[model samples]
Target: MPRRVGRVFRPGSLADVKGRPTRNTVAGALLLLLFGSACAAHKGPTSNPRAERELASDLTRVFGAPVMSQGLWGVEVKSLDSGRVLFEHNARTLVMPASNMKILTLATAAETLGWNFCFTTTLETGAAVEGGVLKGDLIVRGTGDPTINSRNERAAAVFDEWASALKAAGITRIDGAIVGDDNAFDDQGLGAGWSWDYLQYGYAAPVGALEVNENVARLTVRPGATEGDPAVLELAPGSGLQAVNHAYTGAAKSAVTIDFERRVDQPILIVTGSLAIDAQPATRDVAVVNPTIYFAQSLKDALIARGIDVTGGAVDADDRGDLPAPDARRVLAQSQSPALREIATVLMKVSQNLYAETLLKAAGAAQGGLGTTEGGRVATRALLSSWGIPQSTYVQYDGSGLSRYDYVTADLIVTILARMFGDPRHKDAFVATLPVAGKDGTIASRMKKTRAEGNAIAKTGSIANVRSLSGYVHTRDGETLAFSILANSFTIPAATVNWIADLAVETLANFTRR
Candidate 1:
């Protein structure tokens, strides 16, 4: 038997109901059903289960091929809107993150130190001036700022300002040596875990409490005729650096090879090359073996040229207690830069190793410790933990991620991205620092033509055996998702690994939400 409410049939019509207005009741029931369905739809899709399975299949197929080598890899993708894990595989496995570790360092710095932080460099006198002849050393205090490099013209300007200040103080001569105060950091310029082979190269530029010109000298090489003749090695004029050239020449078309070795007994630069005279000039930027001494000497010379005579050679070490009192003086000059946020953008975008390392040290120094790798790690971890992120997952050795010892999981990185996306205070700064696919930074040539090509913004990591990509992507449906993919121990060349990673990202971009 069927019960019905209608206008025409008495048995099946609303009028068939004894003493009740069936039309009004039927209308109410219909409206209630529509409202419930609308509410369910408004909740949105929780997870794309089918899409997750397909993504897993794609990864297995790509890496399981006979030609592919075995490796530890992980991938995780989460929907930003629903906070659901759409896809995940071994997301807890820890592996070397390489340069990708810079993300953590930068994020911690931005949050803890604030983006407007700036470092200061100051000059102090050690003795009272009597008739323009000071009786003690001139102290240059370093605040452990790493931005003071040879490439920075502003640093040179700062040096000039110091000279002007001395002149204004009516001090024309010093009876003692110039002391470099580098006590802001530990004496270990290079970290303990860094490889010995890297020390001789510019890339291993030792971390210094007082860094000048990135603690390196530029040597321009011009090939000389005959194998025995010395190849012309020109140092930056007035750099006060002495070079011992052992470079030799060979026949044309032969490749040039350069090797440097740092002896435990004494640090020395050993140059060897077989470049031909007709070949292009080779230029090498070698790290300054002793940055503190280098800076002191250069400053001494500059001061001497300005009619301020230094009685002795420059010496390295702290002289805070020995400095004279500050006199009433107006600001002679000041150098300003874009806020810390903008500076961080360059650090992350270009993968600037020096900048990252320096910023970490600055944070440590701000937190009551001599700026060092260990100090920076402690400070960075504390910052991340304060943000409610679990610090147990990350192992940070150096800020640049140049060490093979640093390890971080993909899941943790994606977690960070998710937070930054939702955090109004840091959202813009963090996103702007990431490299854009097919446009800039490490991803300038990656993920071309896929939905992720122009829409994805990420940070890339690469080392001898590690390749990682992590960041955010805007989907076709206007949904922003966070993802991280880390591949390690691939037997193939880095180029091939990059190709596979790009493909994975493309698949994620094209996936349809169901």
Candidate 2:
């Protein structure tokens, strides 16, 4: 394997789950005025190293990789008040971004769809209720709501509510198949450049307009009663995926290894591994072969559990455009997703890849009359371009940064962050969606006792060899600084990369311009 370190450097720098840690407090502003007075009174022609070497030195201390190594680091920071670049390192060099790609996907969606937009899932029947019986197919239509399995796991209960709604409308039975409409999005379950190994996991689940349980099924495995026996396996929600378990019970002190896999678009899951006899039961979440069909079947079962008779098996519908238009179908029940602002809030606070991807496709479908990854990318670039962000600055292959082909620069990230902060309509709600340091989201447990605690708000990204953190940091000097630090192809562990990134952010939090 070839190893190379490509990073550009100049002087200057580098650089919440709706928890408004920065929103409720402005006393720091008053303190800033006083601090300004103090600086003016005693400070004289202060030539701070911040202009030349501080950022470079700080970053170098954290990353000790050699020039010929595989490590690539990029740092960019700017003053929110003035869009001046303070530090630049490989600022224009493109590199893979992990989940940091969500920043662009989300920021673009916020601009294209407005902050208040929401997704709708509706249930309708072609025939009217005729005394206890739905005369025709019970149709469920979705516009890519990713919350069905996440944030709230009561989506099936919501389906129960839909069944009850039908019962209240004098329908005792559904005479036809329960149809799932996922045509809002093109049937590209996985993103470009995603690994097959990851595709079988929940985080890389099927991305359809309609999804149930995040399009994943949970499998629980427990050791057998004695050594050398077959382990016990169970599946959740009664998904029809047949499991071929090759797992065996091993010695009590032996390591427990469980592997879950299935062929592309296949319904049979192969489990190969072993569990220690004395090992505790473990659960694994794996992606479903077909999300649209899984959703239809799930709703079918939920309705049946609620006493609604669904005579035929659940059928999945690929596109709503092929069916009768909304005005033409007789609507029976409807479910609306939480407001876009709330969804975005959870999306960032949780670093939700599914939500981000669905929102990307949804934006494309709404704007260009087609819901696909390509359309979403076009819509995102068009919206950001209209806002003065040139598409040439970054190469985006997927909404989520799981794609190794996706490349972006830290400088562009900081540039966008600064623009978002200056956006009068979106600054508050948009900033409220990021993870807060030592408070909420992914960074809740980090930087608790430091100056960055409750003050640093940022997005985190991770992959095997890459880790990234980008966002705003409220400085002790009362100025909000935007920063992006991206490290790719490192030989170090993810924790080490994250710790280095945290050190960088803490440095920014304590930065004082002389």
Candidate 3:
């Protein structure tokens, strides 16, 4: 028989055909046992070990690429199912997060303040109201609610509501000027750490207790033809602000530099610019100096335009004792948002700086006296610490990540994401706020062809030289993954940074557990 290539075994017995012939059946069984052990050694780990290795290899290839040279970059990814780190690279390194800082602020708010939290704006009376007529001052108290003027139409609509309420109350005339009660919050309308240059722009407008139309005024410019002629500038409707037009006409080829400044005491509007008559209409939204007075004046104008008469102009706290109170108690109209969760979702998805700042102040006001950004920051930090997050990880100077000084690590963000996922009360709200890859928010243009496109929900951050992405991604194996990738001092352009973020997300989607 062709030298018996192998031994023939029957049940638990084996036959040895080699030089060492086995006279007993037990000897053959020993030979078979050795064969089985050798085969078992070849099979190790899990069913998908090879797949896991391939996925890891792909991630390393991208990270090690020459294009991504940087100051520091870190990535941390963990599986929600197994609670194991799937991939990690310097995950503990601290770096400037840019707009990604909003993630911390939003997460803190959602954790401390529930999803359904709503802000209240009350019309309180400093004096008594008798027979549908206030005997003293009318107080419109601001609890530091930031959603005061999210939209122009909404702001105008609110004024109409207040006007109707005043008319229905049968108070056609007022004995004193309307008083704006913004003392609910401190006088530090702007954050101490905010930069002066940012304050001059609309994005960095100061947060006030009595905010109207986002405490902004629109200046519409219509340039006059011919050289040396002045440009005509007009204010938007219901904008009780006055401007001194210092804009002059210049050569058609000359570019105009517009300058505007608002002082607190006198509140003078100074506009200086050189305009070419043929240029497109220029428009600028400048922050109002005193939001309380602006709102008071706007309300008075609206009421007067609606046929109601007022005896006095808008007044500050000093004239509160002399103003008449509301004659009737009617809600008139109430402006409510789509819930805190929805707001948070937008704020995180777009990295909305203003919304985050406003939410911070609102939280502080809810805790106690006047709402303030500093108070809000303190409260937010304390709340996070109580939730088991390390205080050192979050270096939040402002609600928005506009400040370059703000810093956060990928590891800290991952920790926060994990905690939020574990909490049943906050799980939905927190998850909903993250940007869906290739669909909406900042990630709308990212992760096009990977499993992460619709499955990965994260927040994006971008500045001059920094880029970051942090959130959750559900793997193909039904495992939820939490990850954060932060890159600083990136040598590539912003578009390239985004590409790297997209690539990392794609890699995570393809990751498989062994």
RMSD of each: 15.1, 6.9, 16.5
Off by over 4 Å in 3: 1-57, 126-136, 150-152, 235-280, 318-338, 449-451
Clashes (N, CA, C under 3 Å) per candidate: 6, 7, 6
Candidate 1 local lDDT, 1-514, one digit each (tens): 0111111221342334467544324323322322223223444444667866776676566545454457767778887767887777778888888778888888778876787887665666546788988777777666655565543475667677778888887888988887777778777666545667676666677666676666766777777877656677776532334566788766667677644445555654566665676678887777666667767877788789877899977887643354444452223323344467866776877787767777788778778868777778888888778777676688888888878778888888888888777777877667777777665777877775556654577888877788988887755444567888888877788887777777767666665666
Supply candidate 2's per-residue lDDT for 470. Answer: 93
Quote each prediction's TM-score.
0.80, 0.86, 0.77
Highest-TM-score candidate? 2
The sequence of per-residue lDDT tens digits that candidate 3 reaches over residues 254-274 is 897767765445546677887
Clashes (candidate 3)? 6
On TM-score, the stronger of 1 and 2 is 2
lDDT string, candidate 2, 325-360, tens digits: 557888778888778888887778778788888888
